[model samples]
Target: MSLPNDASEDRMQMMTKTERFSKLFDELERCREDEQMQKMEEMNGLIDEMNEEELKSIFTIELFDKIHQIIEEKTLPLENALVLLKHVGYYRELKIIYLESFDYSLLRERMKEMIIDENEKKEEINEKILTDLCECYALLGEDDIFGEVLSIIVPCLLKVALKKDETEEAQKEVEMALLALGNIGYWVEKESYGNEIKEIIKYHQEHQNLTRLAYQSAWEFLIKRFHNYESLEEVFVNDLHFAREARREIEELKRDVDWKRKEETGKEAKELLIFRKWIYNIDNYFTSCKLWNEEVEKLLSSFVQMIREFRDNSKKVSNWCFFSITNAAENRNVKIDDLLKSGAVDAFSEEMKQSTLEDKIVYDCLYFFLNVSRRLNEKKDDEKKEAKRKSIKRKMFEWIEEGYEDVMTSFHAILPDLAEKSKFLQLSKYSSDYLWSL
Candidate 1:
């Protein structure tokens, strides 16, 4: 069913990127009853080859307008038009994401015309075409003219999401729209638009229609707007959905039995890492806010559990948790004592023996200790806090006394293996300062 690697390469070698892209659409346009699905798959595969020259070269405004004229003048299928635009959206480069309101209007109108109105004005909305358009706009976030397109596209996406209970088709459309909104969420700068997104995220999540990835994407989208306004931060303080999303996802991962077996290899591994990324992001969002509330406190506690539970799972999981603590610590509000109280030091110490920690972890751990020593130094003259500092230092010493120095030694011993001198120097200073401070 799949093209062999060498054959795929040979096919590629015969055509330049633009040539291949142009030809794919030409084939898609004339493709018949027996070959549609295969042709679609081939078009989807072109996502990898998508770039500025190939896209701009193939779809000049004149060419695009001509296609529009043809679609209107003939009873032509509009699927290839949306498919081409979807590929254009997939080209992630922002400068190339040039949008024209006329182009947007044309696409929307053509999709409407695909199945025309009749008596009772009976209209059949093509969910599949709508799906492609939702995705295209979602991926086309923050383009030069995206602000203009937002008023046009955002409402359409929201209308789909609002119809969540109407039909199975609407529910599927809701899920698709939520994800599409998520793709463009962070780029949302308008408060009205951001609030609309925030409420939609809440509604779908409460209805149990939201996935963890979609939920994460919604917040990531909102943070751009949320960060600039105090009123927005109150969204977190007043609501529990954000924390519930984190807790629900973490609990699911822990309960995922198929993901736990040591010998397993599949999507579980990739998905676990994705879960970790989502957690890390929300974890940072909690810390970034100046306002503290129940959601923040609860999620921080959840993060602690995330580190302690998954530390021994796998190197990837271990490093993932390591990154969580390291990143969370960037915010001073994520107090060091809380991490220690949750056994972060003991958790990391377990990872030090016979464990292969990554270089980035080594970097963060070094600065982490530097920050710790500085905190200790801040309280050095306070006799009242002496016992507290010592008690904390003792836990840290266990990580080093157990196997940390050896880990550091191995890293420094092969310093030349480092590709960049700045990184080498930074690591060198981090190591030297951390050891000296300890």
Candidate 2:
């Protein structure tokens, strides 16, 4: 018979039995297409007689034999061989067989040598192979295998990607690592695996790009894992703020070129202004010197006048009027009456009376008032404390009455029984302890 072309000859030489069987099926179909029905029938009959398991066994054996032949001939391309094996589902099986056939300690030592090599090429080669392995296991519904592969590869990828001398190639690898981590975060329930993911994010926070991605991941992860959130710890928030600011700057840059520039610029300016207020908390702290304070007051008064002019001309109420009152109370440590008398809180209470109590801005004003009140309360003298004690007692009584009314409304259906039991019911000792502690 004539020898096949070089490419086909090479492919045949490297073909495992599994690949041979797959090729046979391909050939038989090609034959049928060419009107070679008799030969196709014969092949189909043979294929039909064997079930999937039997075909798998025959394929595995043939692949093992073919692998040995290619090894002996030294003609096989490792990547091609692996790709063909995976196509036929023999690759992973062969890996298990090969590892089991080895003295694991020797295999491990060799792997260690490969990894510890100072040559970047060798490290890249090893990591690519590892990443491929992980992809295979992940695709095959082997989570434990995938997790194990990642646990090994992530640290190595991080090391390679973080190195000062790493090329753009390494940065691509870092991006891939983030993508892989994101996948892991998706597949695993946040509650079960969030801490481990958070630690990985914490480590990546050293890199600017990685820090932004990490916090973005954590934001989604936290909402998924926990229903309620309070303050992010100061250290975490401060570090994450860098990433947040970077993202904001990037969005601003993009907006500058886009059609939404004006609108987005305004939004960015507003956000940054709000963040400035949050960061400096000037209204809360009031630490500015005389000249600075005078400048701020002048600027604020100008803005207030502009808003009032707009409101009066339009005959619409300004929502921000109460803000001046709250700011005065917080910064000057003065009562609402004192601020109103000084004309610092002009038309503010009037505007507030027209607004709904449930408005978010109103709640913000109330919270600011509460903060101011608590601080003022902290500075109370003995005589003031005595006066406040009666006010506190009256408030406590009102709270108890409200609580009782709510409970009665909720269980109104059981009124007669509830009434009979109410007299006999005493607060449990544990309930008293818990209430006292609160």
Best prediction by lDDT: 1
lDDT of 1 by residue, 116-172 (tens): 221113365555555565566465433332544555456667766656464666555
- Going through the candidates in the order shown, the clash numbers are 2, 2
User: Residue-wise lDDT of candidate 2 within 1-438, one digit each (tens)?
Assistant: 556687786886596544545565444323423343443344343433333444445544344445435534445433333333333222222111222211122322332333334223663465565553333222222232234434554454434334333356654444444433332333443334444445545555554444333333333333322222223222223433322433353344323333233244432222222222222222222222122222334434433453364354322213343443345555443332333233333333233344334333333333333443344344346887656644543443333322433322333343344334445422221212111111
TM-score of each: 0.65, 0.26
Question: Cα deviation in Å at residue 131, candidate 1?
Answer: 7.6
If candidate 2 were superposed on the true structure by all CA atoms, what would the RMSD be? 20.0
Misplaced by over 4 Å in model 2 are 1-125, 135-150, 185-235, 246-250, 256-438
Pairs with steric clashes in candidate 2 = 17-62, 17-63
Against the true structure, candidate 1 has what lDDT?
0.56
lDDT of each structure? Answer: 0.56, 0.37
